[model samples]
Target: MGIAVTAPIILGLTLEHLEVGLALCFGAFWCSPSNVSGSLNHKMKGILLSALLIMVVSFFGGYLHYKTWLILPVLGFLTFGIAFISVYGFRASLISFSGLLALVLSFAHTSQELEIYQYALLIGVGGLWYLLLVVIWHYINPKAQTEEILAETFILTAKFLETRGQLVGQQTNREALQTKLLNLQSELVEHHATLRDILIQSRKSSGISYYKGKRLLVFVQLVEMLETAIANPVNYEKMDVLFKQHPGYINSFQDFIFEMAQQLRFIAEFGNDIKKLPKSKELSICFEKIKEEVGLLKTSEGKADYEDYLMLQNLLEYQEKQFNKIKKIKWLLGNPDMDAKDFIDRNESKRFIVSQDYNPKVLLRNLSFRSNIFKHSLRLAVTVMIGYVVGNFFAFQNPYWILLTIIVIMRPSYGLTKTRSKDRIIGTLIGGAIASGMVLLIQNPYIYGGLGVVSLIIAFSMVQRNYKASAAFITLSVVFIYAIIQPDITAVIQFRIIDTILGAALSFMSMLWLWPAWGFLEIGKNIETSVVANKDFLGKISHFYQHKGKVPTSYKLSRKTAFLETSNLNAAFQRMTQEPKSKQKHLDKIYELVELNHTFLSSLASLSSYIQFHPTTEASERFKMAITKIDDNLSQVITSLNGGKSQNMASTILQGDVFFKEQLAHEKLFLAQEDKHLERHDQEAHLVWEQLRWLYTISGSMLKLTSSIDFD
Candidate 1:
């Protein structure tokens, strides 16, 4: 981004065509945000589309600027049209933002030396030049992004594990821990999506070279590690009770989990440098301590406490599995030549990579009052037009600054727009004050220009990661740029602050009154989608258990869908919390639903992971019955949320509990025989039966909750 912005200024200075250079720089600056992580093909398409949109908007914006009567209608239409493009997906949203930015800036004719067409042409060239640089950088370090993202994934997973470890302590607030887990899961889901895009697309484009294959294997391990961690879900209440009698056992397990998290963080920190990679800690000692503690408990309590013993055993098994996953990741990192053919085939791999729907029908379908994006587009257009009118009424210099603030601060949701408005106001004020001090204290055009360039670079880099800081730098950059040309820098700074404040106030009000889409109004759909995904995931797990072969792509796809939908639900609930208390209808019920959905997914992960690893009995009739009941419950939950009459499953639930208890009792009889070495099938059946019973119980709870809530 720095290179893209500065190269134009340097060239313009050398040729004494500073306006032309700044025009190119403006084009590059607008396009730079779209230069995000993705496949080479995706990146190229986004950048190219952004460049085209910018050029088109620039030309029209300039052509329409002088027509006072047409300005309002054209501005409204252009804003709505540009914002509507976001219906396609994330990259499209960024491109749409770039286009809106260009449109607003088009009204500002800084160069009397160049024609509108010439300025547009220069900006387009700048965008293309940036694209060229991006391609070169991509080719030069193709794997760097993948590695860095993967490393971040490791760190997040570690935090997740660490949070889970906290649940082992009896003093911890289970609700708080669960909230933290949900938040971490959200972050991990995004990282996983990005990895799928990078790793899957890279393999497809370049074929599976050794390094790519190694990275793919490591990614696979990271994903499975997350599943393993999720699979280790415990009944914190049960754990707390157990802690009363076996505190040492619980503490041992907590320490072991923490140790695992530390190891993961170490790998994240040094995994890129093979020579500096830390050696895996020997956890066998920790494992022994846990085992010894459990052993003593078993000895003291005998078979009377077999259930508690089994819980500890299950915890140990999950810990061991997670440890092995970490080890496998380390090995894959060390041995780059390891075969990747055993992993998902190339064609099958593409199924996991989410592709954007570019069909025109998608856009048409969303162009309605019912569509959130449609409403957002309309709101944005009206708000931007209002900003323009206010700016003109006040006769503020650079009236487009108000439009720019509206464009940048307003979002699809009230919570986001409110937050961004606050950040923008704060950042603009601070940045303007500092810049004003600098301009007064120092009178060097050279230094101002240099500072502007540096500020622009930092602003661009921090836009996604730190919006407040990014806003500050952006203010500094803009002020410094104007300082170089305009003598009354103080006026420019004052107008910038006033424009931002006015824009933010207008944006906040617009979201509240302009056909607002409250989070509660949309959260039910998110919950329904998540439940449906979980239902599909359960079906896949049942099929996998019946077939018992290589994990199918369909199974993986269902798991991905479940994870993503759950993340969406979490995000929706968060947004709801940030809205007006009155608008946040049924906040408690919605939160409960979110928690239940997340727990259900985690439970599914546990069942899926166990079947994938340990031997299990064939999908028996009883297992099928349990799965059927669970599936029906989830389906009914969806039906209720969608405002349909759902069938009562009270009798089925009662029958399921009785049947499961009877089966568990029968299975335990075999294991209760101290002298008898139970066959492997009996042991497996015992574990699978336990998981089925737990899932059935949880599903019933979800059904009950949904039935009581008024989704409308």
Candidate 2:
């Protein structure tokens, strides 16, 4: 904001009108709020990339505006390329920034044949000014931004944990809890992506000290564990039954989880100076009480009760491990010199090299009709062409605003497009009113400039956090820029309001009718993808166990991919909820499918957690058969999702296989012998059997879920 407002004002004194102001404001907008963090080198690279792209886009955009004949094909191709490459991370950010700047600049400037070069240069200059400001900002405190972003990641995780704790309450609304969890999952996915970038940047950065670098590496490990630990939390209803007589234990357990979250948040807040933080003794005490409660129930319990007790034991142990992990992170935060290489290597660490993949083959693959990017690109092209022609015919004061709005507002889905349209319209009206009132009351140029600067800063800060607020401030800043040029602010506000509504309407209609992609149809594919990812992850874990050596790179990659795909699936489910009920066919089946997948993953995590403790344990043939059957069932389920025949073949794999019954009989015989020998229950044996039971349950759940869906 300082650079945007000050550079323009500083140059405006020498230049003619507020053209420099508009150019600088947009230049700053396109360059600000970068995902790349840490070193000045990376920051400058991002800024220069944006500037170069802006220049090229601006040059071609000028011609497309002048020669109406070329607008459709040229802009359509650009849209297709930009939208297709956006599937890769970080590329979308730069592409949108360049595209928006070019669209706005080319139309706003009345380009003369010889002055076209000057126009592109002006845009580059504006971007360079922003780059300079950003470089200066980075040097001021290079580590501060990364630290703040890391803090936000922790805070968001805490919020997600707190929401999960709410699910444990007996009186809570199940649907509401599920909805909140989905929203939190979506948000956490976004935060994880941002944090991944920060970690990647820090790893590549030569700017920070070795202490800071290792700390960043440890943080990366910490966040990855966080995802797994919380992935499939204990069922609240089961816990409720376990604590039927003593609900206080349930409350204490919930509070303990919440306290653990608070400790994480404190670590985020205190950073490297965490000595003053209060230790959480409540969790330890609660664990003891729960232990006592379980012991008391043991005397009156049956075999089922004993099984529940074992499950509870596992749950308490896992929670304790998580708590200790948090404490360990806090310790690492304070003592950054501690050797973290082993911890990092165990996860198969890789260096972060940030670069865009503009390979021709990748782009060509995405051009297929089946690609969502291709469909979205075609939709955007049609909408923009229509919007531009209509705006030119009507001769709105700022006709480019219509094109810009359509570009920003039109998403691939109706739900997103409608949501954006509402936010855009509401934000525009509020901004227009605020700007008009400000112009009426304040006549001082300096004050107007200052407020605009502040508004820009606020908007940048809130862009990722809150879009509606960001939009409002964006409107105010843009209007202030116009106010500096035009005497009558009313006309500017009126034109902005009308242009926004028109653009939003066009975008909404286009998304609703043009290449419409219904959520239900796409959701099945997401489910299949998630299942495949989970299967790969499980296979990798099994290989790791059998090898009994260093954890393989495939294990880590599969784990990350599985979680990422799950997040994507969750996002699709959330979007499906937002679409019209009529369009949301088999909603219950989709919901059930998602829930079953989550449950299956969590069960896998439970198995993996045990394997982490006993990596050398040989798998029984029974366990192997169960996994094989589950894998086969997953394949069948995927085929069914893709509209294949159901085959009506019930998987009696678990039901007919005598492995589980034989295992249970063997355990009983062993326990009977142990009773005679006055021995305790075998912990490792119990864990293996528990995991086997969970696999069987997941298999049954999958079968039920597949039955619920209608492929026809």
* Reference-based lDDT, residue 452, model 1: 94
Q: Which ten residues in a row have the lowest lDDT in candidate 1?
A: 674-683
Count: clashes, candidate 2: 0
Tell me the RMSD of model 1 versus the true structure. 2.2
Give candidate 2 misplaced runs (Cα > 4 Å). 15-28, 33-45, 64-82, 111-114, 205-209, 217-221, 224-228, 281-311, 336-343, 351-357, 646-648, 651-662, 665-673, 676-680, 707-712
Clashing pairs in 1: none
Clashing pairs in 2: none
Which window of ten consecutive residues has the lowest lDDT sum in model 2? 345-354
Which candidate number would show the highest lDDT if scored against the true structure?
Answer: 1
| Candidate 1 stretches greater than 4 Å from native | 301-306, 341-344, 649-681
lDDT of model number 1: 0.85
Clashes of each: 0, 0
The numbered model that scores best in TM-score is 1
TM-score of candidate 1 to 2 decimals? 0.95
lDDT of each: 0.85, 0.70
